[model samples]
Target: MPQPGATSRILVTGGAGFIGSHFVRSLFSGAYPGLAGSRVTVLDKLTYAGNPANLDPVRDQPGFAFVEGDITDAGLVDSLLADHDAVVHFAAESHVDRSITGAADFVVTNVVGTQTLLDAAHRREIGPFVHVSTDEVYGSIAEGSWPETDPLAPNSPYSASKASSDLIALAYHRTHGLDVRVTRCSNNYGPYQFPEKVIPLFITNLLDGGKVPLYGDGLNIRDWLHVDDHCQGIALVLEKGRAGEVYNIGGGTEITNKELTDRLLSACGATWDSVDYVEDRKGHDRRYSVDWRKINAELGYEPRHDFESGLAETVAWYRDNRAWWEPLKQRAGLA
Candidate 1:
């Protein structure tokens, strides 16, 4: 395993996106004790969801570099892997709504792009290639949470592609002896997030005095995870996780969509009047919950952020950072 130190050079794919950017910022800010002083190279394609301004905080930090490129490009991926000791992959076509409208992009980026990166890492003899994934790959659970060993039952194209990538990532470890670690996390929300996801979307909309959409009966349940906590778990997996293993990282806070909307409305000083009950997303999973005991037992990982405070902070961030998210919303036609 490659140890985290000053000499460590880590390649972070999708480092300009929401969750990935959080991880990159943490690495540079001494937030991850094990990875302190490690050099980081951010590889981002500057997609619609990726904003270069997201890395502005650490843009000029020592031992930090940014590359604008595609992960599916073998030449670029191969060249970047040559100089890096390890890779933390977060690149993907992640929005389920987008995937439902078009599946090709999801397959290309999530599945093929991952395979390309894995192949390059394998060729370069890289150690500890951490694959960041989602609990959605396990599909919906009616009651109990999903463990690391549970069978994958992804529902949407977005999740199916992620599930495919997860399997291929593990196959590299099993078949080629490449050191690979996988982490599946629940829903993430935090600052610098593009205003497309539910939390950010509703927050921005409510901030603008617009109506928020409540899909179906607003009864769908999801476990909310703060992006900081998610990144912490990924850092743990990157540092000490066993090769060929899957870890489930969760926030342990589960609530119905109706409940979440109520909270967002309260946070934004709005009421149920601003809500629009819409059709539920096609093939939407009723509830998602992950049993994160495995990661906790092995890595001493536990979420430190309180959901109430975290949600409040997230709302405050969007409310106060209109200059950051307004342009993004306008460009995406959400404004």
Candidate 2:
């Protein structure tokens, strides 16, 4: 793929968002061993969830550039792919609640946008196109973890769009012989995440001395993968994974919403009185777990962050980075 051992120029779509930004920052920081000499160009639309501030740390570094644009624009995507060595696509409208209210945006951005990128990458012969996806594509699981082969039964508009994109990415590999590697990862929690997500929403709400909302009985379970660990797993796939294969990246930790709420309450020194039980989200998946043995056995990939410590650090980050997140929350009416 990446010209065997040559230095690569990578195009990172949605690179200003939570997980994507972490991958770009890590690449510049030399965290990804095989990508020490990599040059990165970030293409992001800077939507409400995409913040330029997330890339501020790496902005001054050499071999790093940023472009503001939509992935659905074929002309722009084709022009951008002219120079890049590979693509790590993280672009999508990913909030489940928002997707439920209106699925059009998710359909256009996640499905159409992905098709646009794939078509361009295919034409340009871009190797090792890594499609960053979610475990929610597997839908609710009553028991046992889902392997990559499990049928995709997405329950929400958000997940369905992602599932569609995942298939499109893999299809390019099969039909056009494009180098597409797809990774479905567990729920991610870490810094720079938009406050709309559960962890950030709860942490930020409690920090403001406000009530935190817990849906239904708060028994829904999820595997929490830290952003850094997720980025590392993505790097391993981009570097060593085979084309047309799917990998499941997980945090190796499982917890229910109630347990997670308890941890958050303890972390912020807040009481259960601050917890407000909200109505359940529409078509909310009961549980999600992924079998990541393939990534481990093949690429030596493993999550480096333990859930407890990772959550602590994440809460501390939000506590310390108020100025960075406050404006975002206010703009999005989340404050």
Candidate 3:
């Protein structure tokens, strides 16, 4: 473990993606109080969701390095692990819809890739290995939030892959005594999200004067966590979290998809008339909520951004940064 004031060299996998990019930028931007002096090496596959433009802000920053590679490559992971003090694993195929269409990519990337990283980290004797996961691993909830102890019942292929990865990571810790911590976070929404998620997709579609797709009756509820808040929680876990333990991170706001759509329409200056009710996705989870009391009570983690203000700020970012997302949307054929 790195002592206080000691320079920490962290290898962040999938650092060019949505949540990973935000976390890396924030780490180098003095957003996390004591981590300003830390060095980061970002390893990304530059997949459709991984955009190099997202790291332009930190590209010139000292002590920051970028590498293009796949996490499933054990040789690459082993070489990289030698130079870093800690590993933050964020590399995964996470789109539910994409996984539904074809699960091979998700299984290979999320399961096999995580296993490769874990094996390399264990071999190198890394001090701390933080595996970033999702709340969807618990499947769905009817009325209450799921605690860390809840049995995983993943509904979608994406969530199942994540759950598998989580188990493998924890197994390494228990069997090999590796210092590993897992964080399962709620739905993350903020700037630079790849316009495929619900928040960004709706925001970008509405910005283009196009209709937004709403699945089913739009009554499926989800807890929304801002990317900034989620990053903060992950930082806390990296600093003080225990080994072989699971922590849930949530934004404390619960709203149905319809209610969320209503908010988005209002933010984008659109109306319900612009919403296109699409066919319900297969095996769609009704509601997902995580009980993050463990992280809150132990690490003093709490969401700093409320939904309304965060949503407005996010909308404004997309509105002003048309040059950033326009190309992405066009490439994805969403424009």
RMSD after Cα superposition, model 2: 0.8
**Candidate that beats the other on lDDT, 1 or 3, i.e. the better one:** 1
Error of 1 at 118 (Å): 0.5
Count clashing residue pairs per candidate: 0, 0, 0
Q: What are the per-model C-alpha RMSD values against the true structure?
A: 0.7, 0.8, 1.0
Error of 2 at 155 (Å): 0.5
lDDT of each: 0.94, 0.95, 0.93
lDDT by residue (35-143, candidate 2, tens digit) is 8888899999999999999999999999899999999999999999999979999999999999999999999999999999999998899998999999999999999
Higher-TM-score candidate among 1 and 3?
A: 1
Residue 293 error for model 3, in Å? Answer: 0.8
* Residue pairs with clashing backbones, model 3: none
User: What TM-score does candidate 3 reach?
Assistant: 0.98
Quote model 1's TM-score: 0.99
Q: What is the TM-score of each candidate against the true structure?
A: 0.99, 0.99, 0.98
Point out the worst 10-residue segment of candidate 2 by lDDT.
1-10
Q: Once superposed on the true structure, which residue ranges of model 3 sit more than 4 Å away at CA?
A: 1-5
Error of 1 at 272 (Å): 0.8
Show model 1 residue runs off by greater than 4 Å: none
- Top lDDT prediction, candidate number: 2
